[model samples]
Target: MQFDRKGLSDEDLLRFYLAILKPRMIEEKMLVLLRQGRISKWFSGIGQEAISVGAALALQPDEWVMPLHRNLGIFTTRGMPLHKLFQQWQGQKEGYSKGRERSFHFGSGEHHICGMISHLGPQLSIADGVALAHKLRREDKVSLSFTGDGGTSEGDFHEALNVSAVWDLPVIFIIENNGYGLSTPVSEQYRCESLVQRAKGYGMEGVCIDGNNLLTVYDTIKGVREYCIREQKPYLIECMTFRMRGHEEASGTKYVPPELFVQWAEKDPVKKFEEWLLLEGVLTYSHMEQVKASMKAEIESELVRAELGGPIVPVTTEELEDVYAPVPEVGTDKDIETVRQFSTSRPIRFIDAIKEGLKSGMEEHSNLVLMGQDIADYGGAFKITEGFVELFGKERVRNTPLCESAILGAALGLSLEGFKSMVEMQFADFVSVGLNQIVNNLAKIHYRWGQHADVVVRLPTGAGVGAGPFHSQSNEAWFVHTPGLKIVYPSTPEDAKGLLLASLADPNPVLFFEHKALYRSISGEVPEAYYTIPIGKARIVQEGSDLSIITYGAAVHWAKEYADQHPELSIDIVDLRSLLPLDYDAIRASVTRTGKVIVLHEDTLTGGIGGEISAWIGEHCFELLDAPVLRCASLDTPVPFNLELEKNFLAKSRLATTVDRLLRY
Candidate 1:
C-alpha cells in the first residue's frame, strides 16, 4: 500500500489504473467465454496485470517487448487492437498469426511485442540481439523480456543472462516470480533464496520489487529502462507476486494451499490500487464505476466484433505459399553466369571459400555480423575465420559464450532489425543442445508471423577426423525433416563460396553444413568476384552414361576417387549442393540418363536425407529405372574413432561395391 509517485502526474496514475483494469476485465470475461466453448484456451493474468501494464507504460515507444502467455496487459497497453487479439484467441486468420498459433503465442512487430513461445527461453536471447542491433545502430533503445519463475530453470535462461551480461547488451530481463511454475512451487525450482540475487552471479545489477503495487512497478521499471539506455548495461528485475489462477483455465488451483491464497487475497492488486486512488481523492466512487463501465462496454463491443470476424479460410494452396520469405530462387544456373572458364580459376580451400564468402557479405552488407565460440581471435576450430578479428573488428566478429541457443535466438533477433547474422557451431554435434531454437523458433517464425530469421548457421559436420561421436555428426537429417529451414551442403570450394553467398541472400534460416573433413582436404577452382549458385540446385560433377552416383559433401570426393580408379566403367556423378528443395529435375535427369542410380552420403543410413531423395526418385522416376536405387551410406551405428573402422563405417567402403553391382545389373 506504500509507494512513491516517481514524478508521474495524476493523469498518468489514472491511465495506469485503466491500463491495469482493462486486461483484468478482459481476462475475467475470457474465463467466461472459455467455459462457453468460445476460444480454445486462455492463460489468465488475473493477479499479475500490474507488471505487464507497468512495464509497457515505463518503456519507451521504440523499445521492444517479449511477453509470456499470462501478460495480456502488455499487448493491450501497447495499443494492440482488442478485436484482433480476441480474433486471434478465436483462431481467426485476421489475427496476428493467421490461426497458426493461439493463446498469446504470436508476436506483433507493429506493437514492438515478441510473444513468448512455449519454450520460454529463446525470447530472452532474441531480445539480446534486438538490443545489440540498437546498440550497433546507436539508436539508444533497449529490449525488454518477461518470464515466469519456472523459466529460470531452462538452460536458455542462464545462457541468455550470461550472453547479455558479457556483451553488456541493453536488455531488461524481468521475471514474474509467481510462487509456482505450473503446479510446482518456487521452493523446488531453484535453491537460490531470491531470483534477483542470482543476477550477481552473472555480473549484473538487479532489483526486486513489490509486483502488486502499480506505482512501484512502474517506477522501478522506468528507472531500470533509463539506467540501461544511459549506461548500456543489462539489468534484471524480479517482480514478486502470485498467480491467483491456475496455469490455464482448465488447470484448477487444487494444488495451491488455501492459507497461501488467503494471505495473497489481502493484497489483490486492483482492489488495493482503487482504495489508494479513492483515499488520495484522485476520483470519486461514482467516477471510478463510470470509468470501469466505459472500459467494459468497449471490451464487449470488441468481443462482439471478434466473434463476427470469420475463422481462418482453409485454402490448401495458401497454406503452402508463405512458408518462406522471398521464397528461394530454386534450380537457376546462377553459377555459370558469373564464373565461366573454370580452367582459368584459382584454387581455394573449402574453409577459405567460406571465409571469402563471409568477407564478401560483410563488405556488401554493413548489417552482417559473425558470432561463435572461439571464432573471433582463435579463428574457429577449423581456422576458417583467421585474421577476421583484426579486419572486421571485435564488434562485427564477436566471440560469443558457449551458448548455441542464445546465439541462434540472437541471430533471429538481429534479423528483426534488418541485420543479418551468421552463427557458428564449433561442431555440428553441438547444435543438438540448441535444436529447439532452430526447429521451433527460427523455422516456424516466418510461417507463424511473417518474420524472417535471416540467419546462416555454419554447422561444421561430417566424420573421418579423429573426433569422437560428440564432435563429428551428420545431423542434417534432423533439420531436413523440419520445414521452413533451407539446408545447403557444398562439396567443392567454388560451390561452398557461391552457395554460402546465396544462403546469405536468403530471407529464411539457412543451415550451411561445412564438411569438416573436406575443409582442408579438398580444393576447387573458385572465382574472385561475388556470385551465387542457386539454392536447391544440383551440379553434375562428372558426366558419364554407364551409371549414376548422386552424392554431396565429402562423399562427393569418395565417389570421384572410386570413379577415377575404374577407367572401363563410365559413371555420372551428381553433387546435390542444396538438400531441402531437392533438385528433382537434375535428380531425374541423371537417373534417366543411366537408368541406374547410387545414392551416397556420409550420414548414417537409417533416417538419412538419402531416404527422402531415394523415396522421391522412386515416386517420380520409377519407370526410368534399370535397377533398384542403391543407397551407399554409413552404417547406423555411432561414427567410430579408428581410421580403418571409420573407413568401413563411411560410404567410401560401400561406394565401389554398390556402383559395380548396379553397373553389372
Candidate 2:
C-alpha cells in the first residue's frame, strides 16, 4: 500500500495498467454499440484515459471525486459495477437515476462519488461543499472535481476556486485542458497562456503536467492530495492533454487539424503505457493481448446483464411518485392548543422571528450551518445573522464570498454529508446568478436520483418602500413553476418563525421567501418554544361569507386592510403560507362559501402566480361562484422607484374595485 519515492511497486504498476485498460476496453465496446444503435451517446476519453485513471488510483477510497463526462475511468476504477453503469447508459429503471436522467449525471454515495451536472463548472462548487464538510468533521480527506478547457470561462469555476481558496478548504480542481472545448480552440477560450495561471488570482497554488503520461498524473495528484490535507487549502492541476476524438461521437473531427491528431496519436496514453510496461519486464505482448481479451469478454457479459434491465415502470403520482418530500401541515386546533400551553408567547417582528427560528434550528440540530455574504460579523445584508457569531461561533455562522452558485453547490455537498445548511441570498433578484445551481442542481437532484438536498435558501424578497426594480421585485413565481422546489412565503412574524421550522424539517430543498417590507412593519405573537406551521397550509386571517381575498406574502396585509375598511362586505382572507403544494382545499372552502373571489398580489399581472390561482378558481370553483373570477395585480411593468408611481403600481385600489364589481355581479 505504500508509495515509493523512486518508483511504484511492480504490483501497483500492474494495477494501474489494469485500471487504464478497463475504461479503454469498455469505451471501445460502447462505441461499437453506439454505431449499432444500441446506445444513445458517448463522450470519448480515448486518448485522455490517464487523467481519470491516475486520479482515481491516487485518491483514497474514502475521499470523494466529482467525475466529468469523459471520466468513466474514475467510476470503473472506483469499483462501480459495469452492469449498473451500462443500464444507466441504456436508460433502464434499475440505473442510479431510474431513467430520470442519463449518462454520468447520477452519483453514488456508496462509491464515494458525486455526480456532475450538464453544466460542468457547478461540480467545482459542489466539490467545495464536500471538502468543506470534511474539514468541519476534521477528517483528513480531500475532495476533487474536474472541468475542461471551456468550463474555466464559467463564473462557477472562478467562484468555486475563490471560495475554496479563501476558506482554506481541502480540494483539488483538476482541469482537463484537452486542446479544445468541442470545436473551439484554447486560443478562443481565454487569453491566459495556461489555465494554471488562474490559481494566482484566487491565491492558490497551480501546476501543469503531461496528462498523457500515466505515472506523471498519478504522482502529481498523489502529491497534491497530500499537500492539500497538510496545508488545508485548494490547489489547481491542469492536465495538458489533447482530445483525440470529436467531443462526442455525433460531432465529427472535421474541424480539428489532421496534424494535431497525428501528433497526439503518437502519445496515446494506453498504448504508450502498455509499451513502457513491456519494456520494464512488467508485461509481455502475449500477456497484454490475453488481458485485453479477458477485459472484452468481461464487458460483453456485463452488457448482456445490463440489457436485461426493464423499462421505467409507470407511476400515477406526480413526478415519479416522489419528486417532492412530504411536508406536514399544521396540527389540529386541539393539538395546537396543547402545543401553545408549553411555550411562552411575545410580540416579535417578522425579521426577528426568522432569526429566532434559524437560531432554534441551529441550537437543536448541531449539524446546521448558516452561510451567506457578510452574515457573520455584519449579520447579513439586513442584519438577520448579526451577532450570530457570538452565539454559534464563526465556523457555524460562516461568511461566504459573493458567489451564490458556489454557496448553493456547497449546500448540496453538506447535505450529502448529513449536514443541513441555511443559504441566504442578500436579495431575491440576485438569485438569478445562482439559478443554474438552484434550478438544475438543487431542484432536480432529488427527482433525478432520490438524493435529497436538505438545504433552506433564505430569499429576502418582494417590494415596497421604493427599493426599485432590482431590489424590490417579487420572484417567487419564478420557482413556483420549478417542480422540485418548495416555495414558502410567510406574511406574519408567527408564520415566518413557524413555517421556517417546517421547512427545515422537510427532506427536500425549500425556498423560504421573506418580504423585506414586512420584516419590521409586521409584528405578531410568536411562540418562544420550537413550533412548526405546516408547509402546504393556508391561514384564514379573517372569516367571512360574502367574498374571499386569497393571497400571500406582503399582499396578505393589503387584503386584510381592504377587508377591514369595507365592513359592509364580509370578506374571507386566505393567506397562502406555502405556494408549491398549495392549500387548495382551504381555497375551495372559502370560494364556495363566498361564491366570488379575487386573487391579489403585489407583483405584476401577466405571468404572476395570481394567474395560476385565477385559472384554478375558474376551473374548479366555477359552479360555486356567483360572478367571474377576477385577478387584482399590478400592471405588467417593473416596480417603480418613484413613490406615487409605486403606490399606483401596487394595485390596492384595483382590489377594492374588483371586490365591489364582483359583489354587484
Candidate 3:
C-alpha cells in the first residue's frame, strides 16, 4: 500500500495529497450548491484528480497548462485561491472571468494557464502554438494540454498532433482516456487498440500508464518534461482512467452500470493514495485527520466568503463592453504623408498591396508570424507570399498542412503567447473546414476571457469568370453574422493595403476578405509604408443625390462602372469596409441625401450583408427614404463554372437594372 517517494521530499508528497483532496472537497460543496439551485451544473473530477495534480506539479511555474473542464485539481495545484474558484461558480465579478464565464471555462495569464472551452480538442492546437512561441523566443518553458478519449476523435486532435510533431514544439498532449466520452464509450469512439498508438502516425513518442497511480503519473510527467525540453519535440501520454461521477450534476448514473462503478470504487485514486501515505508512515492517523479537517475548514471558509460576495448583477452597459480592443491611432495625417513620400510611389495590384502590407507589418513587429497551406514555398495559391519565405525565413512564414482548424486554433494560442498571427485560408470557401474554431474559439476568446486573440484570417473570396463554386465564393456574410468578429472586404488596392494593416494592428479576430476577381483587375496607387485605414469606416467612392448604392469588394468596381455609364443618375456609392462594426453615420448620410437605396454584394441574394443593410435602412432611415430599398446580389444557386452563366449569376446588368428600378420608385 506504500508508494516510493522517488526523489520527491516528504513535503512534496504531502502537497500532492493536499492537491487531490482540495478539488474533491470543493466539488462536493459545489454539488450541494447545484442541488439547492444556488449554482449552475458542476463537472466533478472526483476520481481523476491525481492526473491533473500530478501533471501540474511536474510542470514549472512558468510553464502553461491548458486544462479541460474536469481538471479542477490543476487550479488547486497551481495555488489559485479557493474563494476565487467558488466566486467564479457563484458568477461573481471578482472571479477570473469577471462573471462572464461560469464553471471551468476560465484561464489566468498570471498563472500561465489557458481558459478552457467546451470544445475540448481545440486546446491541443492552442497548446502547440504556446509551445511554438516558447521555442521561437528560445525559452525552455513547455505547455501541457489535456483532453479526453472522445476529444481524440475530433479533427483538431490530429491537427494539433501533426503540427506539433512537424514543428518539434515543446508540448505534452495528455489524453485522459476516461472510460466514456459522456455516454459513448471508448469502444464506440475509435477502433484503435489504444489512443497513444495513434501518435506514431504523427512521428511522436507515446505512452500509456495507470493514471490513478499518483506516483506513476508524477514520475512519468517529470521524465516527459525533461525529454521534451532536451529533444524539443511533442509527447503524447494516454492516461487510462475512469470518470467515477456522472458527466455533470444534471446527468444521472442510469447510463452507467452499477458493477462498473463498484469496480472503479475499489481503485479510487484518493483512497489508494491515502492508504499508501498512511502505510508508508508519511502521515499518522492524527495527521490524516488533521489534513481532512483542514481541507474541510478551508472549503467552508471559501464558501462563506463566496456567498457573502453575492452574484454580479447583470448590467446593460457591461454587455456591450469587451467586444473588441480599442484601435490604436498609430500615426497622424502628416506622418502618413511622410511615409508616402519616403517610399517608392507606384501603382500595384490589389493582391500585391496586401503582400506589401504584410511585409510592412512583419518588418515593424517581430512577433507577427504568417501561417497557411503552401504560403511558404508555393507563395500561396495566388502567389501573394511568393518571396515571403525567402525574405522572412521559414520560421516566421510557416507552411502549414491542410488542417484549417489547427491553423486558426494555433493562431489563437500564438496570440495568447504574445504574438500576432496572420492566417490564410487557401480559399474563402475552404474556411468552412475550420468554422468551429473560427466561430467558437477565435471570435469568443476575447469576449470570454478578456484576452486579446490578435488573429487576422486572410480569405481570398468572390467569383467573376469561371473559377467554379469551391474555389470562388463570397462568404463574408457568414462571419458578419457572428459577433466579436471584425469583417473587412476592401474594394480598392489602397484600401486593401490600409485595411489589412489596420486588421493586423487591431487586437481582435478579423476576417479579411480579399476579392479574387479584383486581385489583378483592380490597380491603383498604394502607399509603400505602413499606414492603416481605420476599421469600421466606410469610404464614399462617389457622391450623388439621385440614389445610393451601398456595396463592397468586387461589387464596388461594378457599381463604379455602372455609375459612370449612367450619367443621368447621380449615384452615391458607399463602400462598406468593415462589416461587423458597420459605419452607420456614412451610410445614413448617403441614404438620406439620395432618398432611394440599392444594396449590392457578390454573396447569395438570400441571407447576405445586403439584407442586413436593407433591414437597418428600413428600420432607422425609413422616414428619410423617398422610395423602397432594393438589393442586387448573386443568385441563390452555387457559382457556375461557365463564364457566361457566372457573369449572369452576378451580372452588372442586374445591378444597373435594380438601381434604375429603385431610382424610379
Candidate 4:
C-alpha cells in the first residue's frame, strides 16, 4: 500500500501543524522546568513532534495505542492537556495519570490507550493482545504501539511481532528512529539500514517515512492503518526523526557531534509544518501566534489546577480496592424454576471441570485465547488442556517456546492488543523465571496508569507424587506479597473450573493456581455449560462449632480428610479460593462460631498464607476466639526429593491428629 499525498487538502495540513505546537511547547517548557528544579528530568521531542502527532491522528478514536516516553506529542495531539502533562513531569498527584505514573506515562481509558512501561518494546506484546481482542469481538479497531530504535533489541519486540504476524493481528508497530539511543548511535544498535526492514524477519510488512514531513508521516500512517484494518496484518513503520535534545535533562548534548545537531535542528518538524501551513495559505502568521497563545494560556491554567493537588497518600490496606462488575445475582430456588434447576448442575472433578470450563468459556467468548509452553498440540505438561487445539483451533490455543519470561512478556502485548489470554507457566515452580515480567511489568501497568489488562496466568502448584522440589512446589506466597495481582488456589475440580472461568473474565491480571496433586486425583460430575465462581469468595466445605481450619489447594483436601477421620471432634473447614482478597468475612464467621482457628498451607511456615491468615484473624477476630489463633505449615526447607523426608515436613493435620491437637489446646 502507498500513501496518496496528492489527495490531502491544505486544511488537513493546517490542522495537523496546529495540533503539534502544544506538544512541542510542552517539551520545551518541561526542559526549562528541569533546569529550574521544578522537574527532575525531561525527554524532549523537539525535532520529532510531527511523527508523533501524525501517527496519532491516523488512528480511530477507540483503537488502542501504546506510546514510549518520548512520544508525549502523540498523547497531547490526541487531547491530553499540557498542564496534566506538566504535573506528571513535576511528580504531582494531579498529573496525567493521577500520580500513578511518572513523567512520559500518560493514557486515557476512554480513548482506549493502553498503559506504558519503561521496559523497551514490552508494550508491543500488549498491543498485539489488544488487537486480538478487537478481532474476537468482530470490531474494526486496531492497535498502534511505539518504541525507540533501541527497543528493537529487546526480545519482547521480536516475540510480539512474530506472534502478530503469524496470527495476522490488526496491529502497527512504530519505531521512532531518532538517530541515537542515549549517546549510542543507531549504527552501533543494529546492522540493518532501517528499523522497519527488521519486520521481514517476522514475515510482516515494513515502511519508512520522512519523520520531519508532517503531511508525509500522517499520510503514510493513514495508509498503513487502513491496511491493518482491512487486511488484518501487522506492519512496522520506521519514522526517521532526529532527537534535537539529550536523552533526558540530566544528560547534556555534549556527546552528540556539532555537525549532526545543526543538520537535524535545521529540519525541525514543528518549523517545517508551520512554514508549510503558511505557504499553503491554510494559516496566517497571526493565526499561528493565536494558537500558540491559546496553548500557553491553557497549559498555565492546567499547571495551576495541578498544583491544587499534591502527591497521593498510599492506600493503607494491603489489598487493592475491589473491582467487581456484573456481580452474579442469587439464583431463584431450583425447585421453583426448571431453568434454575438446569443451571445448578452437579459438581465435576477439578481436572475435568477445568478442561470443560476452559472449553466452554473459549466457545462462548471469541476474544478468549489460551497460550503457553506446550499448551496446544502437546496439551500442556499435565494434560489439563489435552484437547484444546482440536476444540479452539491453532489460532486460539497456541504453544510457545520454553522461555517463561518471553511467554509472559509476549502475553502483555497480546493483552494490549485487546485479547484476553490465559497463559500457563507449565509448572508453578517455573513462574519465578518470569516474575519480573509479571510483577514489574504486567502487575504494575494498571497501578501506573488506570489502564486495564485482562490476562490470566495458570500455574500448576503443590507438592506430592515425587515431582521433586524443582517441579513439585506451591509458590503462591511469592506472588501474594506483590500488589496489583489477584491469586486463586482452588482444591476441588468444581471450584477449579469455576475459579478459572471467573479469573478469565476479570478485568485485571489474575494468577490462577492449579494443584498438580489434584489434576487427576479425584473425579466428579460437572455441568456441561459455562459457569463462574467468584474470585474472592470462600466456600464452607464442612461446618462445625468446635474449631475452624482455614486452608487452600492440596491442603484443603488434607484438611477435609482429617475432618472426616475425626468424627468425634467438631471442626469447620473453609477453602479460600482467592488468596489476595482473603475471604476474611467467612474466616471471621468461622472464627466467631468456633473460638479456635488454625490456618494451614503446603508452603513453608515463614511468610506463607498461614502466617498472614493467622495475623489477620488475631487482629480482627481476636476477642471472639477462646483459644489463640495458630498456624500449621511445612518446615522451612527446600522440598526434599525423598518421600519420607517430604512427608515428615508436611503439616500433621489429619482428622485424628487435628482433633487431638484441638482437644489438647
Candidate 5:
C-alpha cells in the first residue's frame, strides 16, 4: 500500500526542527536554572517537544492556543522569548506570565495564547468556549488546548469535548501521552489502551502519532487543522510521547522503570528530528550543529537579558490594597439621589424591580438571558419572572435542571458565547451548592484569561422571614471574600432596578443579593426610562456628622427609620450597593466625617459582612473612629420557623438599637 503525504518543504522542515530544538535546549537549561535558584519552578516539556512545536506552527497566528504548563516548545514556537519564559520562572517582572500568575501559568495577549492553567482538563473547556465565541463573532480562528493522557480522566475533558463535537466547534484537543501522570502511570490512570480511542465516544475523528517525530507531529496537526477548517469539526490528537523529567523540577521520577526512561531517551525528539531532516536532505549535518549552537547562544543571551531586567516587585500587602473597583455612581442623578422620594415616587416591590430590571435589560440588550430553577413559567419562588415568559418567550427565559453545577456551568457556556446570563439561585442558602462553579470557575474566568465572563448571579439572601435556616440565610460574606466576584445588595426597588441594570452592563461577574424578606414588603419608585446605577458605588441615605450607619440590603431601612426618630443624634448612612467591590471610599469618607462607626448586616455576627467592613474601616479610618467599629448582626443561631422568633434571631431592627447604643458611645 502506498501513502501519499503532502509533505513540508525541506526549508520549512529544517526551520521547524531548529525552532523546536532550541526550546528543548532551553527546557534543559531551565532545569539547571531551577536548581541554581535562578528560576522558581519548571514543568519541562522535554520529551514532548515535537508535539508542542508542530501544533503551534500548524495553527494560524490569529488562531488561539491554550497550552498547559508542560508545553514550553509551543510558547517558544509562538515567539515567547526564552529569557521572558525564564524570567517567569525566576519571578521577574519581565516574565511573560504577568506578575500575578504562578510560575507554570503562562500565555500572551499579543500572541493570542489565551491562558495556560496549571490545573488539568478545564483548559479544553475554556478553549471550546473561546472557539464557540469565534464562531459567533464570525472570526476565522481555531482554539487548541493541550493536555496529558491523565487529564482525560477528568469529567470536564469529556464534557468539553462532547460539547465541541455537538457544536462542531473548531477546537483541537491535544493529548500528550507522556506515559505517567506525576507518580501514576497511564496503565493506572485509564483502562483504555490509548487516549485517542476515547474520542470515539464523542463521535469525532481521532489520531495517534509518534510524538517524537517532528515531521509526524507537524504533518498530523497541519492535516487536522486543515480538516477542522474544511469540515468545521473538532479533533482529538493523541501524541504518544514520553516524559524524561517528572511533573516538575522539584520531583524526581525515581519510581519510574529505569529501562523505560532509557528506551524513550534513545528516541529523543531533538536527535530523531535531526536524523529525519538529514535523511530527507532537509538539513546538512553542519546545519544541525549550527542550529544547536545558535540555540545555546540565544538561550544564554536571553538568560543574561532576563537577569538584567531584575526580580519581580513582590505584590506588597499595600499593593493588594483597594481591591474593589471605584465606588459605582449608585445615585448619580439627582432624582435617584433622594432615597425617600425615590421610594415614594413609585411603590414597586423588590420582586417587581427584579422582573422589571430583567425585562428592561433583555429589551435593551438581546444578549441578556435569565436562567435558574423555576425562573421560566413558574416565575421563580418569589414570582419575579411572572410576565417574563409571555414577554421574552421561552428561549430567552429558560428553566434549568436541579443540578446547580450544571446550571452555573451552562451559564458559563452561554456567557462565553456572548450572551449575558442572569442566573438566580433559588434561595441564598442553596448557593453553597453552586459556590464552586461561581467562585472557582466563573469569578476567575476574566482574570485568568484577558477576557470577561459578563454574568449576574441573583441570590435571594437575608433572614427575617420565618423560612428557617435552610432557606432563610444571608451568604454575601462567602462571596465578598472572593476577589473577582462582585456582590451587590440593594435595599429598595429603585436601587434594585438601577443596580441590576448596572450589573448587566458591568464586565465582571456580579452577585446580586436580593433579600427574600424585602422581595414583597420593600417597595420604591423605578424610573420609566432605562437607567443604571454604577457598581461599586454607595448611597448616603442620610447625612449626619455625629455617627455613621453603614449597612446594606434590608438593614438600610432599619438604620433610616432609627435616624428619623432620633433627630438629635445625627447619623450618616452608607448603603453599599456592591460588596466585593464594596464602596470602601464611601465607608472611609463617612467614618472620617462622622468620627463614629457602626457596621451592620443580617447574617450572624460570628463572621458576617460586618466583620469585613469593620476590619476595612480599622485599616483605613481607624484613627478617625471615636468608637471601635460597632457591629450589629443576627445572633449566631439558625433562624427559627416562628415569624416573631425569626425576626428576633436575625438582625432586623438591631441596626436601630445599635445606633441608639452608639449614640451614647
Candidate 6:
C-alpha cells in the first residue's frame, strides 16, 4: 500500500514512529521483567501500538484521555516518565497510585489521563462527563476515550453513547476492535455487522479505519477530534486492529487459532510503520535502528532504577486513612455552631429543607452541579428540585436520561474534574441498575488511587403508606456494607438540611438517603443559613435513663412517637445520622446509662443494619446490658402492595410490642 502523509510535516511523522517505538520497547522489557519475577503481570498491546499513539498525537495537551488497559502507547506519548511507569510495575511507592495499583491501572492527573479499571465500558461515561464540564465552562477542550470490541457488549457503553450524543458532548469514543475480548471472539460477542454501525443509532458520526497504518490512524483521529471540538458533539471511531500476543503474558494463544495469530503477526503496526517510513524516505534504516536502540537502553536503565527502589513499605496504621475527603470549613465566615444561632424560626417540610440546602450549596460553590432524571423542567418525581432549572440554568441543573449507571459514572468523572456533583436517583430502589458502577468504581476510587469523588447520590428511600417494594426500599444496609462511602439518613428537616449541606462539602462519595415517606409528613425549623452537621455523630433526640432506642431515618420518627406515648418507660432516643461510620461513642454512652437497648430500622430483619448494631453493642457493652439486645425490624419478606399488608408489616404496634417485651425482659 502507498503511504499517505495527508499534509503532515516530516517531523510530525517521525514523532509518530517514535511514539510507536517507545511503548513497543517498554512493553517488550516488561515481559522480560515478568519472566524474571521482577513484575507481577504484563498486558501487552504488541501489534496495536499505532491506535494509542495515533490518538494521543491527535489530542491537544489540555484535552483529557481515558485509555484502556492495553493502551501503553498513550502513557509514553503523554510524557509519562519511564521511571514512574517502571516503579508502578515494580510496586514502589513513587508510582502514580502510590503502589496501590498495578500495570496501567494508575492514571496521571498532571497529564489529564484517567487510569484504567478492569471493568471496561464505564469510563466512557466518565469521559463524557469531563467533556460536559468543559463545555459547561465554555472551554475548547475535548476528551478521547478508548474501549475494546468486547466492551461494546457492556450496557455502560450504550448508555454513554446515547447520553453523549443527546448532550452533544465534545468526546471521541474509540473502539480498538482487536477481534477478541479475552478469549471470546467478535462473532460470539454481538450480532452487529460492525460495531461502528451502532454509532448511527446514537445520532453520531462513525468511521472504520485501517488501524495498522500509522499515517491513516493519525489522520483519522486528528480529523475526528477536530470535528468533535468544532461541533461540540461526540464521534465514534472503530480502529480495526489486532493484538499479536495473548490477553496477558500468562494467558497463551492456545485458545486462538494458530493461523489467525500468524495472519495478525504479519501486520504488526510497528513493523508496518517502519517499512512505510523507509519506503517514503522519511528516515534512513540506520536512523530507525538507532531510535530503537536508544528506547531499549532507556527501558533497561529505568528497569534497573525500579529494581533498586525496593518494595513499598506497608504501613498498617495508615490503612484506614484517606477513606474520605476531609470536611471543608463549614462556610465563608460561619461555622456550624455560629450558624445554629440563626436557625429559621418557622418550620418547613423536609423536602423544602433539602431544596434550600442545594440552593445554598450551589451558591457557595461555583463548581457544584445537579443532574438526574426529570430534575430540570419537571423538578423530579417529588418536586424536590422544583424551579432549579431557572435558578441555576440548564448547564448546572442538567436533566439526564434514565440511564442510572451512566449518570453516576458521569458524575464521578465530573468530580474528578473539580466539580462537586449532586446526582439524584428518581427512586432509591432503581439504584440496582447502576449498582455495579457505584460498588466497583465510585466506592473503590479513593482506596485504589488516593483520589476523592466529591459526588453525592441522593437516594429517596423507605416505605410509608402505599408505595410497594420497588418504589419504597430502605437500602442503607446495602451501602453500609461498602467501605469508602459515607451514608447519611436524616429523620428531621433540621437534620436533613444540615446533613445535606455537610455531605456537599465532604470530599468523598456520599449516599444521602432522604426518606420518601418523610418528605412532607415531617416538618421542623430548618436553618435558612448554611450549616453542617458533622458526619459520624449521633444526636440525643430525647434523654432518659430507663431504656434506649437506637435508630435512624423514618424509624427515628417512629421511635420518638412511641417514646412520647409511654411516659412511664422514660426511653432515650439515639438518632444515628451516619451508617458506615457508626457513632460508637454515643451508643456506648447511651447504652451505659440506660442498661437496656432496642435497635430499630425499616429494612428486613435478617441482613438489616440493626443486626450489625446489635452485634457491636453485644461485643463492646456486654456487661452494661441489662438484658440481651433486642431488634425491631420488618419481617424478611418483599414489601407487599396491599396497604393493609404493608401496615401490618411495619406497624408501629409491632414495634411497641417488641419494645414492651425488651423492657419486661
Q: Write the per-residue lDDT of candidate 5 for residues 1-665, one digit (tens) a residue.
A: 11122655666766777777877788778777777876676777888787888888888876778788777777778887667766677766666544556665655657777555455666676676567566656666677888888888876677678767866878888999988889898889999878899889989999998888776787888888878777878999998888888888678889799999889988888877676667767688887788788778888988888788754566666334423223234344432444344444566888888888888899987877787788888898888888789998876787765655545655665555567788888998887866766787677655443446677888888776677878988878888788778888999888898888888877668888998888898887677556787777898888888998899888888888777878887789999877877788898889988999988778889988888889888888878988888999888888788988887887765666776677787
Runs with alpha carbons beyond 4 Å of true place in candidate 5 = 1-5, 153-155, 158-168, 187-210, 213-235, 311-347, 359-455, 464-472, 543-548, 558-572, 588-597, 616-628, 637-648, 653-665
For lDDT, candidate 2 versus 6, the one ahead is: 2
For lDDT, candidate 1 versus 5, the one ahead is 1
Q: What TM-score does candidate 3 get on C-alpha atoms? A: 0.98
lDDT tens string, model 1, 1-665? 78577677789788888988999899888988998998878888888888999999998766889899888889989888999998888888888988989788898887888766899988899999999999888887899999889999999999999999999999999999989999999999999889999899999999999899988898888889889989999999999998888998788899999998888877888888888888888867998999989988999999998888765668877777778888555334345563554324688888888999999878867889999999999998888888988988999999999899999999988988889999999999999988999999999997888888899999999889878778878999999988899999999999899889988888889999999888888888888877788899999988888889998889888888988989797889999999987898899999888989999999999999888888988999999999989898999989888878887888788887787788788
Question: Candidate 6: TM-score?
Answer: 0.98
Candidate 3, run of 10 with poorest lDDT: 330-339
TM-scores of the candidates in the order shown: 0.97, 0.97, 0.98, 0.84, 0.82, 0.98
- Model 2 TM-score (2 dp): 0.97
Error of 1 at 566 (Å): 2.1
Candidate 4 structure quality by residue, lDDT tens digits, 254-357: 88889998888778878866776677677898988998998778777877786777666766451244222233343343111333347655656677888887
Residue 643 error for model 6, in Å?
1.1
TM accuracy, model 5: 0.82
lDDT of 4 at 4: 35
Candidate 6 per-residue lDDT over residues 361-430, each given as its tens digit: 8988899999999999999999988898888899999899888999898998897789999999998999
lDDT of 3 by residue, 1-665 (tens): 24668988888888888878888888888888888987877888988888998898889977889998789988988898888888887788888887889688998887888888888888989998899899999987889999999999998899999999999999999999888888888889999999999989999999999898888899999999999989999999999888788888677667888898888888888899988888877878899899889889888988888778754687866767766666666777524456677766689998889889899888878999999999998899899999998899999999998889988988988988889999999899999999988898888877777877899999998898589989878888888878789999899988898888888988889999998888888899987767878888999998999999998888888999988888887989999988988999999999888899999888999998888999999999999999988989899999999999988888464986787677677
Candidate 3 collision pairs: none
Clashing pairs in 5: 327-536, 328-536, 328-537
Q: How would you encode candidate 2's per-residue C-alpha lDDT over 1-665 as one tens digit per residue?
A: 12223467788888999999999889888889999998798889999999999999999987889888889889999999999999988888888887778788998888888888888999999899989999999989999999999999999999999999989999999999998999999889999899999999999999999988888899999999999999999999999888778899999899999999999889999888888888878888898889988888899999999988667776757454568655445455413355588778899999999999998788877988899989999989999888889998988899998899999999998888889899999999899989999999998887787778989999998776898889888888889999889999999998898889888877789999999999989999888888788788899998899988999998899898887788887889999989988999999999988988888887788888889998898899889988888889887889889988888888674887787788888
On TM-score, the stronger of 5 and 6 is 6
Q: Rate the local accuracy (lDDT) of all candidates.
A: 0.88, 0.88, 0.87, 0.77, 0.76, 0.86
